[model samples]
Target: MSTFTLDELVRVLRESAGEEEGVDLEGDILDVPFDDLGYDSLALLNTVIGIQQAVGVTLPDDIVSQELTPRLLLDLVNGHIARPAAGKA
Candidate 1:
């Protein structure tokens, strides 16, 4: 299982926000909400899919409903990595 890093979360979130060229996110972004970062539920779902692929974990689609924030994402991914599923999604 691959433990997620804050930096990785930033990059994935930035990409998930639809920055095709990608943005160099820095500083305190963990505290920022996904909506503030320009993402809605649909976009956040996309981001969650990206996280699933990147981290090789089976994540529930409703995770975005829990709150689409960097901090929440980081914590969730860490939890998944710490306890990976027997079968991946």
Candidate 2:
């Protein structure tokens, strides 16, 4: 399974946020508040969809309401994305 480290996650977030290159994705992502990440609610939803597309997994329903910090997001994504699908019981 593919796993996104905090660094890769920050890079994707930076791109999704429309940040310019040469900017520090980690520092910038950590510093900016989620509301000021340059994306609106819909845009944030789109970003979530994009992550699902790239990672081949769907996040939980409450993802948007939670995970306001980079570290929290990393944990959520890592934990959920790595979880096994419900089947084969």
Candidate 3:
């Protein structure tokens, strides 16, 4: 299983929704809220879609609304990736 790293998240975020001016995504932003990073719910939703496409994971529909920070989101995505799909175990 491929681990979803912060770098990948940053890339998807930038691709789905352009970063805010003066906001450095390369910085330590794992705990930073998406709003503080100039990302609204819509941007996050788009990013979630992008991640699902890239990582081939079926995240929950409310994932974006639930995971507000990169760390939390990463944990959730990685958890999904680590677990086997239904009936596969």
Candidate 4:
């Protein structure tokens, strides 16, 4: 899998946060909290879906309950991307 850079991940988060147009995607997403991202649980679920769509990997459910931060999310994505394909054993 291709590595997803921090900037690209931040841009995706910003877009998911509904700030996609001209806003600076580099800004901190944790400026307030996940709620302010204008996303309800369903939207967040869809955001995870977006992540899957963009990166071709599924995020663990616990990641959200743990209060995903920008940095942590990037780390999680990086980890997923770095892992070998399933059933390669």
The residue-by-residue lDDT of candidate 2 on 19-88, one tens digit each, is: 6445555565654545555455655666666666667677764566433665666666776667746211
lDDT at 76, model 4? 71
Better of 3 and 4 by lDDT: 3
For each candidate, what is the lDDT? 0.73, 0.60, 0.87, 0.61
Give the winner by lDDT: 3
Report the candidate with higher lDDT, 1 versus 3. 3
After the best TM-score superposition of candidate 4, give how far the Cα of residue 54 lies from its true spot, in angstroms.
0.6
In the range 1-89, model 4's lDDT, one tens digit per residue, is: 67877677655655564553444545666443455544556555666667777888867655564365556666777777787353132
Clashing pairs in 4: none
Residue-pair clashes, model 2: 0
Candidate 2 vs. true structure, TM-score: 0.64
Off by over 4 Å in 4: 14-25, 30-32, 36-38, 84-89
Tens digits of lDDT, candidate 3, 1-89: 87999999999999999899999999999999898999989898899899989899888758776348999999888988988473133
> Cα deviation of 9 in candidate 4 (Å)?
3.0
Question: lDDT (0-100) at residue 89 of candidate 3?
Answer: 30
Worst 10 contiguous positions by lDDT, candidate 3:
80-89
Score candidate 1 by TM-score against the native: 0.77
Inter-residue clash pairs, candidate 3: none
Scored by TM-score, the top model is 3
| Candidate 1 lDDT by residue in tens digits, 4-86 | 99878767766766642333357566767777666788888888888887887888876776346788888877887887762
